[model samples]
Target: MFGMADMDPTGGLWNWAASSSLSGERVQGALAGALERTVISLDAEGMDGAVLCDVYHVSGDFPTLIDVYLAPETIAETTAASAVAVRLEVEIILPDDSLNPTRYVLADPAGGLRHVHVDEVETDDGPERRHVRPCTGDDPACAAAPEDKAA
Candidate 1:
């Protein structure tokens, strides 16, 4: 579980060519279904696990669900003041045959890109939507150490 870094109005979200190589087997843990809607949720806790969020995409007309967890602590950070970070989650339902869900990104690489998979993906927020910041880390402020990675 991870939290959304408060709204950072400083920089732009890192954008890249969209990727869609998610296979039914990629998300092995996901219950088999016809593929449908996506749900995103956020929650906050104390110091230990201050924040957490999950994206659930339901497949087909059946009643199955696919869950993707986002960890802010593991997200790429470019600044130190993530102070305003807040938890934000959303869900969207797509038609049964949505080979493409508006847009997509490549996350969690595996034996090269082919084996790579999608992570923390939501069908609602597409490229048309502008993001203030590339979600900074959930920490009230960037860690004492700046980073180029989600560590």
Candidate 2:
């Protein structure tokens, strides 16, 4: 059962994690069921002619978007995006202990998000400092910068 907080405007986060390899079809199917009402399926063209069926969940009231991609070899394919629905994304452990759905995102006005990094530009009377923050909580692979590291 999902917690009320998990189903609310609270943006759900996920990272590239899994004790065992997960298939793209499995991820897409799971997300489609979890977000059946809001999900929009798409067959996006990828590089090298690799076609990917991506799933996106968008809330009509919020700019929040949940992107579920097919997991490739090694890395799980799925992430959630939100602009201003909440301050921080909450972590939820699914029944499958091997799976990790703790990916998150901060508000991005510039819309610079690549992989698991969010481009954060800060100008405080000095040289413009542009650093990358991880979209998720704490994955050594997708670790956030020291300044943005969670407590």
Candidate 3:
């Protein structure tokens, strides 16, 4: 089950938790259902097309917190423009594990979903920087785009 803890014009955060006896597949289905419900609610409130920015387990426990970051997209040229930084996090978790957590799932305006992973690499300047890339075979629920699948 899940519940929304906070919400605002910019975004919202929700918490999801399931029983330990539940299978990983069931957990995934529940998570997807929660996301779908959230989208519907947001759309009803005129906040459609909000992008999911982060998902992480709370304190390495059962309840997971998901952060959805929303920003208005300009369909035409406007006076002011703003930028938002997106960071995706990736870590290994078994598919059969009941608490499977994903870093981020981006929902585009075209209704396309992109799963991405973020890695930190050490640069020449001796600083670690995050690099985001598409989800690989190891990731759970990772799938190719519709066009790619058709080809």
Candidate 4:
């Protein structure tokens, strides 16, 4: 089971590109590469067996959300040892589908999850990229409406 202590420090990197103009495929590729490097670094630190990582995309709205799930113990241990250094150049792109807004849920072994909403809005300056506030239990945007559920 994972807890706050098990969360990846590099998690913020997930939002690093919250305000860029890249394609969803490109963003996914970049994240996958970063995650690969993280795994390799862990292996180099002789902690390969201590951790496992997975990267997958959830399609919804523009600015598709990519979820990176890592084994808990490895993150805590490797972070404490300062073994992984992750650097990323971030840019966000809209998903192919324009029907729904994108929301990414990153879940750990214990079922704990974090939600990230990526979206773009038209502004006087052109298009502005932003992350909607993290979803809460009462946030209608966080989940489908009651009618949606009934349907």
Candidate that would win on lDDT: 4
Whole-structure CA lDDT of model 2: 0.29
Order the candidate numbers by TM-score, best to worst: 4, 2, 3, 1
* lDDT of candidate 4 over 44-81, digit per residue (tens): 34444322332223322323333233434333422321
lDDT scores of the candidates, listed in order: 0.23, 0.29, 0.29, 0.35
TM-score of each: 0.21, 0.23, 0.22, 0.28
Give the poorly placed runs of model 2, Cα more than 4 Å off.
Answer: 1-16, 38-42, 45-151
| lDDT per residue as tens, model 3, 1-151 | 0101121322333222211223333333333343443222222445346433334332222223333344223210010000011111112211111122333333322323344443323344221223435666554544433433464
| Model number with the top TM-score | 4
TM-score of candidate 4 to 2 decimals: 0.28
Order of models, best lDDT first:
4, 2, 3, 1
- Ranked by lDDT, the better of candidates 1 and 3 is 3
Worst 10 residues of 2 by lDDT: 91-100
